[model samples]
Structure formats: C-alpha cells, structure tokens
Target: MLSDQIKTKCTLPHSLYRAQQIKDFEGEAAALAGITLYSLMERAGQACYDVFNTHFPDARQVLILSGKGNNGGDGYIFAALAKNAGLSVQLCQMGVPDDLSGDALLACSAWQAKQGVVEGIEQADFEKADIIVDALLGTGLSGALRPEYQRLIYKITASGKPVLSVDLPSGLNADTGAVSDVAVKADATITFVGLKQGLFTGRAIDHCGQIYFSGLGITKQFDSLCSSSVTRISYQDLSDRLTPRSRTSHKGFFGKTLILGGNLGMPGAVRLAGEAALRTGSGLVKVLTRQENQLAVIAGRPELMVADFDLNKIDDSAIRDWATNLVIGPGLGKDNWAKMLLDFVLASDLPTVVDADGLNLLVDKPAWKDTWILTPHPGEAAHLLGCSISKVEDNRFSAVRNLQHSFGGVVILKGAGTLICDGKQTYLANVGNPGMASGGMGDVLSGIIGGLLAQDLNLQQAATLAVCIHGQAADLAAQQDERGLLASDLFPYIRKLVNP
Candidate 1:
C-alpha cells in the first residue's frame, strides 16, 4: 500500500513556499549556514539515496534519468553513491554531457570519476531496472514539455517500474500544481529545501503518490529568510483545538445551530448536514425546510428539531433570534424558496456556513460578509469566480484567494487537497482521500464548520479545524475499502475525532 511506503521518521514542516522563493533565497540560507549551494545539492542527493535504500531495500538495479540542471546534478550524485554501494546503477543523461555547466557539470564529473557510465535515453534498459529515479525538468518547468522530454516521460511511464521522483515530478507546475501536457507519476517523491506548495494540491496529488521531505540541514535558516507562501495542515495538527468541554456544561452551553435548506424532494441533503452538525458537537441542531420535508429530515434523527419554513410568511427576524450559528444551502434547489431563505440567512450577522446552492445564489447576488464561511468545490468555485472549472483547478491557490477577496470571510476550496483562505493566509489540508468524492460530502463539511462556529470558534479556526476533522473522518471510514464508501459512513468517525 502507498501508506506503508511513507517515511515516518521525517517530520514535514507546516510552512510551504513557491519555487521562486526557494531559488531566490536558497543561496543566502546556505551561506548563513556556512555551506555552499553545491553542498545543499549533495545533501539533497544523499536524502534521495537514503529514501531509496529505506523504501526499496530489496531492489538491486536502479536507473537514474537525469537532465542538465541542478535536479539532474542531484541524480548524478545519487548515482555515484549507489555505484559505490555495489548496486547495478545506470545513469541516463537526458541532454548532452557537454551542455552541463556549474554544479551539474561537477556532479557529472564525480559520477564519471566513480566509473559510472552516462548513457543516453536510447540506451536506458527500463525492463532490467528495479526502480527509476526521475531527475528531469524538476520545478523549473513552466510550459509544455519539450518533444524529447515528452517522449522520454512517455517511455518511462510505460515502463511499469516503481519510480522515485527527485524534488518534484517533471511537467508539474511548481506554483499551480497543474500539468500542462504530461507529468511523471512516481510511486514516491523526495523533495529538498523548502516544501513546494504545488505538490499537495490539484493534479499533483495523483502524480505525487507518497511525498518525503528533506530540508538538507538549512531549513531553519531558509525558513527565516522569507515568509512562507502557504501553510500545510492536517488532522493531527488541528485536533488539539477540540479541547475538553466544561465538566458542568449543559445543552445550551454548546450553542444552537440552525440549518436552512432541504427544498422540495431534497430532504436527504439537510438531514445529512444536520446529523453531521450534531456529530460535531452542536448543542442544539435544527433544520428549517419546506413543510413537506420536515418529516423526512427528522425521520431517523430525533435529535434534530425540524421546523417548516414558509417563504410567504418569511419571519427572518424571529429565525435569526433563535440560533447562534446558521448553515445555508444543502440540497437547496435554485428556486424562489431557496433564494428567499438564502437572503433571509444572509441578512443577519449570525456566523453562517454556505455550501451548494447558497454559493450558486451568491454568484448572482454577490454578497460579501465577514461573518460567513463559503465552502465550494471546484465547479461551484468556478461559478462564483465567473470562470471555467478548469481555470479554478489550474491554480487552486489563486482561485481560493480570489474567492476570499471577492466574497469576504473565510473561503474553503474543496478538492483532493482542500484549501482554506482567510484573506491574509492560505492553508492546505492534506487529510482527505478519493472516497470523499461521493455525494453529500460538501453538505457534511458545511455542517461541521457551522457546528464549530456555533461553539464559539472564530471563522479561520472553525473552518480549518472542521476541514481537518471532516477529511480525517473520511480517511478513517475508507480504510477498509474506498470504492463504495458513503458520506454517511463518516458520522461515527466524526464523533470520535471531535472528542480527541
């Protein structure tokens, strides 16, 4: 399993940086540590070698595909180390040996000094190798791959061998995580220097299977040189926020959460959200839906208080006075009734969590409020941003930032690597799995955030903690099988995680 191959000894840093930041400040960081850039490269290569030995201990034959850059230099250094260690190692240099310069040329010379032969791509024996090391292109790639690189990448991918990528897989945008044409999909990736922000989101998640980080002994210096572009978080990091509740607390101490949605024929959406809120520790949970849905919404869940919502009557002030927190738009169809309820919820200063049709409604009305949190998947985010879904996925960090700027409050852009932005800082939650793609997941997430907000957590804290809890619940529920997992499977795990 992919999880079994992960390196648990190395702790990952919470701060993430752009590629340019690493390039610009890496030299100064090294200098501050009294080390040269080439020394950093050597440490990077050694880190990769250590990961390979630890993970692929049984493998004897290795193939290293190297380009004419620092990334390739790291590969050359690793090749020399492997050859000296009595492994059958073949180094395939992508570009001409004469084209190499600076530290790359020196690395190539070191490999040759160790009697390691540099072969061309044509001579690489993919079938004979137990593993392939991808050191081509690295994080410098911006546009589509060159024809030669593309052909090599296709050949390597088709080789059906376990692959380890150095720094990052080739053809992946270090800033956006988007692959223009093609990218190397590695079984494991060992990154150096600062952790690249792009490796955790969008298409990069599929390409970068298991990630290992190495700061090369200069991380503290490097991190001090510049501010990080993003923050990476997970359930383990945020679970402490769910501290022990007051021993003498009553039902009203936790605060009440009022959920508005479940239009005609859509009772299931509101039911799931209300239950998730209850599981997340909301003191009092209420669902205000169409009169016809009141029974269905509260059928199996007796804890939720169900009430009939009539658009014609529209007692907005009375409803606002009842709950401490509001959740709008689960199974809320884009109808006049849904619109009126959304407007009613938006009119108040109550902390609100908006998802599904509430986000779609905002695309037209465009209300910006500091007291609400907007959670949108890629499709809904596209609509809110007035762009294509592809555009939003192309650069999720940018999309989430734009969403926060335009809509105000905190914004959660949900996907493989869910991102939360609070206008000032951006956070990436690396907790969820593919099984979470099923229906009603967003509704559950919205409810979780609303429950946290109701419990007196601020917008950023509530959004970040809720996202971690929601995704971690899905991860636990999918441990047996991810293929047929349901959104409701997370309820038990959610209750357990919140207590931690």
Candidate 2:
C-alpha cells in the first residue's frame, strides 16, 4: 500500500546519451537555454555543492582534486561555493594552475577571488578531508590513466574517505564503461548536461557507487536534442502494468509455464527455475525431467507438476499442448535425452526463454525465432558468437546488439548491468547487486522471463520487465544479507514486486 502513495513521474522513458553525444550538445544546449558556458558550469558546481553539503553535513574540509579540463572548472567553482558557504575547502590541482583556460580559467579566478588557495597534488593532504571529490577526468578520457594519475587515484581510493566524482569517474571510458589500469571509486557522482550510457553498465558499476544527476538548467534543450539508443528500467516504469489483478481473477487467467530441464544428476537446477516461475505469478508450472530426478525436484514443492512418466512412449506434440510458454535450459544437458527434448520443443510454436546448458546446444545449430528470449552470460555468449569472453567484455553494447542480430530474438546479456536487446531497441537494468554473483541466478532469471511470457507479455516487454524485476528482487534480498544471498532468497521479493 505504501507503494501506491509514491508518485510515478516520466521515469523509464528518459534517454541515456553516449559520452560523445553529451559533449556534442553541451555548448548548444547551454546557449539555447539562455545560459552561458560558465553559467552552466556554475550551476553544475552549485548542484554538486548542495548535494555534497546534504550528503556530508558534518564535512569539515571539502577536498577537491581538480585537473586542467572543464571538469576541473567545475571543481574550482564548487570550491568557491563551499568557501562562500562558510565551509572549509581545500583545492588541489593535478597540473600547473597556469595551464587552466576558458571557462575553467574563469572558474579558477572566481575561486581565487574567494581567497581559496590551490595547491599541487604533491603538497595536498588527503587525511584532513571528510569527503574527496574527483574532478581529474571527464568524458574525454579514452585510454588508460597516466602513471602519476594512477598513483594519486590509488591513494585517494585506499584512503577510505567517501569520494564524489564529477561527470564520469576518472580513467573510465565514458562511452563503453571500460576501465584501464585504475579508476576512482566514488561514493556518489554528480553528472552535468546528460547521463552517459557508460555509467550504468560494464565495469562502471564498481566505480560509480551512487549517481546524482543534474541537467544544469538545460533540461529542455538537452531532452530535445538527444534520443538515447538504450533505456534504463525501474519499478515506476512498470508498476502500472503489474498492478494487482482483479478480485475475480483466477489462477487459470495466467498462463502455464512448461519447464524442460533437470537432466540426470542436476536435479536442483530445474527445481530452482520452476519455483522462480511460480513465485513470479505463473498460473501453473510443470517440470519435465529425467525419471531419476523427478522426486528430488518435487520434494519440497508440491505445487509443481513434476513429470517424467512415459516420456519415452508419448509423442512430442502431447507435451507442447500442455503449456502456454517454455523455459528450456537450467540443467538441460548435451546428452541424447536432452537433444531429443530440444528437438521436440523446436517442433512446437511455444514462445521460449533459453538459458544455461540449453544455450550451449543452440549455439551449435543456431536458428532464428521471434518468439524466443536468449539469456547468456559473457561465457555463454562467447561460445554462441564464436568470440573470446574478453571481446564481449570489451564492448558489451556492441556484443549484445550483435547477439540479437545473429540470433534473431530478444537477447539478454547478463552481468553487472544486464543488457536486453531485441535487435531494434535496447534496455538496461541497473537494479542488481554483486551478491547475485552466486549460482542459480541465471536459471531464476530465465524462469521469471518465462513466467512473464506465460502472462502473454510480448518478447520486449517480457525481457525488459522480467530482467528489472529479477535484478530488483536480488537487490531487496541482498539488503538483508548480500554475502550469503541465495537465488531462492529472491522468491519473496519476486512475489511482492509482481503484485505491486
């Protein structure tokens, strides 16, 4: 009921611009907004100042690590504002102050006018500051950090003080979310002009702890000029679609999710998937497994229809008619029995969400189908695309897009920030945590997608909504105990989110 009171704004429709795109519109956006470049810089600095004060109310000395770029200009402006606010401020320059120019030059002058002295990194003290702001690099950063910058950043990170970064974290590739050598780990980041697509995916998650965004008064201009290639999903975007069902609604109103897995020794895998399907609002869930593991899969879950009887005798068409959608993978092995089951499913028109070992089999003889969702981790995706895991890791955006085009279905590249692509549109889920690193997570994700598919959601909606729900459920479970989090722990949260 508390969720009902929370206002839902224009949430998930917000576009995420690439680093280049954000830079492309900065000057024009400022001009169109009836503001100057320095004025926007001042506003960016002011926004950061207000947020910094709120977050670090007891902060004594605000230490800002400034570089020679426009990002440093923001730092200088922030330092000036901090001084005016009667807060202690310390400004450290990465290079000689003589090198600063343009808006940055004006910002530095404004800071000096406030009697704030700038010191070089060699003379600055790290221990005296409560919160450190990293303004060393912005979107222009491409290659790895220089040796000097790495040492200082390492020192700042190892200091354990809460760090705030301006724009993108220093040394992080703002476009691809790739990090070379080292990047600053900030407790919170204040971004100006636009939200870069890189900050929400890949290795960027580790560096960007909490993000604080400000359009710097160019909201109208920025929104009009940019259209994101990808979108970010949150609960607000989908809450209306997943509202409580009518009082008269029955279980049969939802679709049946038929799960085919649990091949010989791996009985627990299929059980996890089946239970997740039920938890996520599937009307009925049936598991087709080997006779040896049928009892083990249904030991504690009596709701599931676990069947392996007469599978050798019955035809493939009989199984297809029993369910609305299919989740084929979680323990689907490469053995003959597994292959036979795969071929049988292939003969049907059932919409399917594939994962785990089933993904392995599909890679060998790839085919196209619009009614399928492929969930592949970096390793599995590498095998399917015949490329190295590092290549997939290097540029996840391109990899996911390639996978969708090659596989002809909605593809979910699972990782830190899961990427969901359907060849035309792409979406990103930023709700998961590192605790979801445990096993059975992917299996659970496949089941959730299958459950949504059973509810008659289209390929894109099922993939997008399911991925966000799965990740957010993990986050909720992880809050209690992230380190010891289990895939099954998400059951309660999944049930709650689906009902919200």
Candidate 3:
C-alpha cells in the first residue's frame, strides 16, 4: 500500500523537478499559493524525521551528520525535533557552525538556543547510535568531496550505523548519480521538495537504499510550472495503458507485426521476439529469418509464421506487405544478409523498433529516417550518437534526446532509467531492477513493443507501454529471487499482464 500510494501521488523525479522549477520561477506565485521555500525546507526535515522514526523505532541514540547548507538546516531542525520527541541526538559538524548561512544558519541558531550541543570532528562511535541522519550534502554538491567532509563521510561509512540520508547522500552527484570520490551509504533515503534525477539511475540507486519521497506540501499545480525530460515505469501502471481487448474484438482488429532478424546461430532472438509479440496482443506475428534457420524460428512457438528472408528472392514490396509494424535487431548479425534486411525495413514506412545488432548496422551505415524506435543499451546508444559510453553514462538524458533528434524517430535509450524520446516529448522508465542485467532482455523488450504496435497503439504509446510492462515483468520475476533469473522467465508473467 505504501509503494502504491507513492506511485499514485509521487511522480518520477524529473517530473517532480519540473514542477518545482516552475514554482520557483514564479517567484511570488509560491507565496500566493501559501507555499514558501523555508516552509518546504521545514517540511522536508520533518518528513526525514518521520521516515527515520518509522524505519528505526527502537533506535534511541541518533547522530546527525550535517553540512553548512540548507540540508544541514534540515538536519538541525530534525535533530531538534528528535530531542523534543525524547530521543538522544548528537550533531557532529563537518564544518564550523559559524560558517553556516541563510536558512541553515538560522536553523542552527534555533537549535543552539534550545541547548543542543554542536561538536567538532571527534571519533564518537556512531556504531553506538541507533540511526545516523546524513544531511552532510545536498543536490548542489558537485565534483569531489572536500577534505573535511571527506573525512566525515569516510568515518560515517566505517561506523556501520544504520544511515538515513536526507535528500541525496553526501558526495554523490545528484544530477549524474556519480560519486566523485567516496559517498555515504544509507539504508534509506528520504527525498523532499523536489526529487533529484540521480537518485534513480546509475550508481545512485544502490547507494540510496529503500528510497522514499515526500512532496513537502508542494501543490500539484507546481507540476505544470516546469517540464521534466524523464519518466519512470512501475508495475501498477501496466494495466492502465495495456488493457485487455474487448469481447467482440477479433484477430483482424489488431495489426500485423513482423520480426526481421535471427542469423544462423541466433534463432532464439527472433523466436523470443515472435513469442513476445504474440503474447503482447499482436494479431498476426511473422518471423522473417534466414533460410538455414527457417525451422528453428518456429521451434516451440509454432503459431508464428516463418518466412525465408532471402535477398535474391525477396523484394521491398513483399516485406512491406507482411509487417505493419517491424522489429529489426535481436539476433540480427552485422553481415550482408542483415544489412539487406535492415535496408528493406528502413525503406518502408511501417512503424519499427531497431535494437541490438540492428543498431550496430545502422551506426555503420548512418542513415536518418523516422517511423522507427531504436532501443540501444548504453554502448549501442553511444556508438550511434558518436560519443564515449562514459559520456552517455554521465548524462543519459542528453544522450537520449540527441538520438531522438538526429535519427528522427522514437528512441528507447535502454538502461537503468530507460529513456523514451519521440522528437519533442521524452519519458523516463524507472521500472525493472538490477536482476534484469541478464542477457536477451533487450530482445524480449523489442518484441513486446512490436506486438503492442501491431495491436494498433501509436508509436509513443507502444514504446512506453512495452518498456513499462517488460521491466515490470522482470521486477516480478525477481521477487522469487533475483540472482538466477533469466530473460525467458518473464514470458509467462508477460502473458498474464497483457492478456489478463
């Protein structure tokens, strides 16, 4: 119920930031709405206290690691509240309390007036504490940790205290989720006011364990104030976009989908895609593969029709006539046969999703066209966009936006936070888990999107729905256990979700 309520009321980080940006830009508009930045900060601190107490009810001794920023102010406020609530609290200041400015200084002054002791860098054993509140750094932190803060962070990590980070963890870059040097590892992180983008992607997710969000009394109207370039995919969202068909609907009502890949040794790629399309509600599914693997394409899934995609015999018109929506990639090799198949698909005007080897071939040839969805992992997306994989990793939002604008089609920049872009609009998918790091996952996703497209969903809708459902299935599969989970394991769950 908690997670469900979060999904329903709390939005993805990017959307939350967009809303806050708009509210901030309005200047006095927030005041008009009975909202103030200081009030937001107080609410943030209070929410952090609530989450900490809820997670560690038995923890009596609390240590608050505070910086000289508004985040520190939050910690100061929280420490005061904890003390008032009859919990023993300690403030280990990373810097001089006199160095604090703005609301943070005011908060410290308030706490000091209340007889709170502010101590300097001392090796007070945090292991003896019940919980540690990390308010040492805020989203404004960039680059490496300063020397004093570095020592404090290292000590906190080594202390083995159960940590509850206020907003983002100290030393972790909120925009990139990249750690400059070392970062505080928290058991739970409560983000407030606006959700930072970094907490959900890259290394941030691992560092920020058991994440929670509190809007801090910000109105929903603030959402319209800013525009976010990211979105998240959740299990609860799958059925809303992918409802079952009407009782009177027939196979003819859905469109035809074609899977164009599966080289000599990779018949499973096309097979997985074909089966996924069928399961995802595609009316008619066809596999256009090499003649050598014609029988292999329909191995277990005999319902799908197999076509021998021989270049010498097949023409563009013939391929066009079969697939209303095409998914090229999966096991597609970067050979001449694969090239011819890709050329045929690109020339046609049908909606298409290109992934895996299909992306590799397109990078080599470098053609620009629309009506396609390129689902590339970081490496593939990097190659296509002509940048280093690290650069893409550092800034996924920018990389995905570039891919969409340059390629002139919807782009599914697949990774932890899978980005979906269709020129003007961008959506971020926060579904799935680290368990989905296994092989053949991209193949399954490609097929799901192709199938959704065949069912007459528009390109944008199909991409979002398919990505959400695919990640959601993997998330569910991992519930049994994540370590040994396989890509094929998601099939039954996918069928249940789309058809149920």
What are the candidates' C-alpha RMSDs? 2.2, 3.6, 2.7
Best by lDDT: 1
Q: After best superposition, candidate 2 residue 86: deviation in angstroms?
A: 3.1
What tens digits encode model 3's per-residue C-alpha lDDT throughout 368-414? Answer: 67788889999998899888998888777778889888887789888
Clashing pairs in 1: none
| Per-model TM values vs. the true structure | 0.97, 0.92, 0.93
lDDT, candidate 2, 331-417, per-residue tens: 889987887777776777789988888889987768788888999999999999999988888788999999999888799999988
- What C-alpha lDDT does candidate 3 achieve relative to the native structure? 0.80
Candidate 1 regions exceeding 4 Å error are 1-10
Q: What is the lDDT of residue 249 in candidate 3?
A: 93
Cα RMSD, model 1: 2.2
Index of the highest-TM-score prediction:
1
TM-score of 2: 0.92
Task: State the displacement of the C-alpha of residue 351, model 2, in Å, after optimal TM-score superposition.
Answer: 0.9
Residue-wise C-alpha lDDT for candidate 1, range 38-58, written one tens digit per residue: 888888888898889877888
Clashes of 1: 0
Would you list the C-alpha lDDT of every candidate in the order shown? 0.90, 0.84, 0.80
